[model samples]
Target: MNKIFFDNWESILRTLVITVLAYIALIAMLHTSGKRTLSKMNAFDFVITIALGSAFATVTLNKDVALADGALVFLLLIGLQYSITWLSVRYKPVKKLITSRPSLLLYKGEVLNDVLKKQRITIEEIYVAARKKGIGSLADIDAMILETAGEITVIANLTDDDSQTLQNVAKK
Candidate 1:
């Protein structure tokens, strides 16, 4: 019970020093990796972000995890992410394999029940996304898509006369 609240002063000091240094190292790594290192472009990018965060916490809090080891792991993950993204850009098949294509949830104010079911999305969720996009009614929506990053995108006030902007979103 006594040990639960009171760790030694030396341990606390060590944690503080390691935490500060790890934070600096992480910032430096992210800067070196470029802006896309932190972008939520797809599920893989999201995983990389989560892994970096986990590594940061481990390096800061786990005394067993050496700072040097943690830094190397961080760099490796960033490098792998960069490499994969580079290859994905040059190769369409790799891009398709690594990232999910955005799915159309609604087209022309009609709820695509089949698409919604396939995407595991509810109509209420679509309404919520529409509401967030400041859409007062379904009739005002042109398209609603579930992006690769699992975000809902709503394009509103579309009509038959308007140019089709959903060419990129995969239709079911």
Candidate 2:
């Protein structure tokens, strides 16, 4: 019963030391891996972020797992992310495989029911996004895009410029 509350001074000191060192190693590796390592740009990136957090926690709390082993795991995961992202940037097939295309939910003030249904998005969510963007009414919104990062981008009906930015977004 006592062990449940207090293990020992040595164990506590080891945990503290390991936590600081592991954290420093993680920060260093994240910096070396580049900005993409920390970006939540797509689902794959999100998974890597979650895995990193899980690994950090395990390493901090599990004394059986050595600090060197934890650092190696961090390095491996970051290296894999870097390689995948590097390939994705240079290859069209890799990019398509790893990420989803942005989708157009509303176009020309018309709600695309098919797209909304396919994406499982509600009309109320669209209204909330539009209102957050300072839109007064649905008619004032020219386009509402569901970005790859799962964010709703509300474009106002007032843009006079050509929509070159939306060329790649799936409109269905």
Clashing pairs in 1: none
TM-score of each: 0.90, 0.94
Q: Please write out the lDDT profile of model 2 over residues 60-126, one tens digit for every residue.
A: 9999999999999999999999999999999999999999999999987889999999999999999
CA lDDT, candidate 1, residue 153: 87
Per-candidate clash tally: 0, 0
Best candidate per TM-score, number? 2
Model 1 scores a C-alpha lDDT of: 0.87
Tens digits of per-residue lDDT, candidate 1, 1-172, equal 7889768998899899988988898889889888888776688998888898999999888989998998998889889999999999999999998998889898778999999999999999998998898888887888888998999988885656344666667889
Q: What TM-score does candidate 1 reach?
A: 0.90
